[model samples]
Target: MEWLVLLLIGLVGGTIGSLVGLGGGIIVVPALLFFSTYTVILNDISPQVAVGTSLLVIVFTGLSSTLMYMKHKKVDYKSGFLFFIGSGPGGVVGAYVNSYLKVDSFSVYFGIFVILTSIILMFREKLKRKEKVNHFPFQRVYTDGEGTTYTYGFRPITAVIISFIVGFSSGLFGIGGGSLMVPAMILLFGFPAHVAVATSMFMIFLSSILSSVTHMTMGNIDWELALFLVPGAWVGGQMGAWLNTRLKSKTVIHLFRMVLIIVGFRLIYEGLAQ
Candidate 1:
């Protein structure tokens, strides 16, 4: 029964997360809550443990999903790497704080942020001005390790600020922060959807790695549970990438945020209800 529970949870959560770049937090957190509802082991930890452990699984989730984006050439190495500066350190600090911090203090903001981003993502076309960048936004020429040279329209300051905030959230909430990061890259920085998604996966990778490490430092991660979660996330992430390709961008974007708002409220309600 335990094995079955874990498997189903992984499949359901993994599929949704991979599909939407949700990082499986919506599923994992609630699933952990459910698991604890009837079980002794996982139930014993404070809410902090649950959030920390859920974050730990993302290490594998990012690894598995990022490959699909790379294969498609949707990744923008320059911006992705630049964004790393903020996510990496922020993740470490955030993870450390979560071990002893009260996430509830921040939950309201998290919900609000998610809700707002969802709204913007959904109504993206309404917000866009006619001025589109035909040229890259930065003056520097970047060459990827594979020797693909390109000019980007992205501003580093923007990436740094967003990455820092996103990273802080990643650590604090144990959410991947992609739900916030991906859309921002698209709507604010003018990254293509695929590029945004691909880049966000890698960014999630860095953030999750630091977060997991910090959680483990507190002896918080359940490796046994991660074993159940990671493999399934990989499969789901691929199918998600495929779906992202087929979906109507504007419609999906709008729907994505509405989903976030609903889910965010649902999560907050569930947490408070408990």
Candidate 2:
């Protein structure tokens, strides 16, 4: 039963994470903490363990989604690699910080972060788009499947600084840096939504590698639970990538925002009550 729950969590996390470019750790980390605390099924799950395990699962989820996005030509490889330059080292730093958080404090902080992310999603569409800067050193022109061309660019140093913050959040919370990165790409960097999602997953894959290694050295991972979670996350990533091609995501986004709100409040309440 515990294994079954873990599988479902991975599947749901992967699908939503891939579809939205949030790196599925948002779902996995919370679910692990909730189940371990509120039920008899999963026992002895510390926040550190949950975060480490989630990051490991994100590695597979990001890989599976990235491969699918690559075939679709949605991923911007150059930008993804560039973002990784900052995110990799930032992730290591974040992982080290995670060791200092206690369960109640972790829950409260994570809840607040999740709620803020959902709010960002809510207001993102209404936000004024950034004007294109033609003189930036990292200019990109992307053509999607429908032949719609998008021109977006950012200074390499600016991008690196932003990505470092995103990676730090991912390492500290294990929620996949994409939650922050996707919005930054769209609002700050002028990336098309699909392109942002794809590239964010690519960055998540790379950053997760560094963060997970840090967690591994800290002995925070649960190998048995990760074994169950990873396969489901991998399959779900493929499913999500396929769905992103077919679905209109507005409705999905609306539903997901509600879920995030509920989960965020619950986590906050749990932390305060404890």
Q: Rate the local accuracy (lDDT) of all candidates.
A: 0.68, 0.92
Cα lDDT of model 2 by residue, 1-274, tens digit: 8789999999999999999899999999999998888799998799999999999999999999999999998999999999999999999999999999999999999999999989988986565546666877788998877788788999999999999999999999998888789888988888988889999999999999999999999998999999999989999899988888778677878999999999999989988988
Please give each candidate's TM-score. 0.80, 0.97
Query: In candidate 1, what are the lDDT values of residues 1-274, reduced to their tens digit?
Result: 6666666666665556655566766567656755675586454445566667778777666766777777766666767788889888888887777766554544454566557656655555554321354454553343444676543356678778889888877887777888778767766665655566777887887778888888788887777777776666667667666666567455555665566778678656654654
Task: Give the lowest summed-lDDT range of ten residues in model 2.
Answer: 124-133
C-alpha lDDT of candidate 1 relative to the true structure: 0.68
Off by over 4 Å in 1: 38-42, 103-121, 124-131, 134-152, 249-263, 270-274
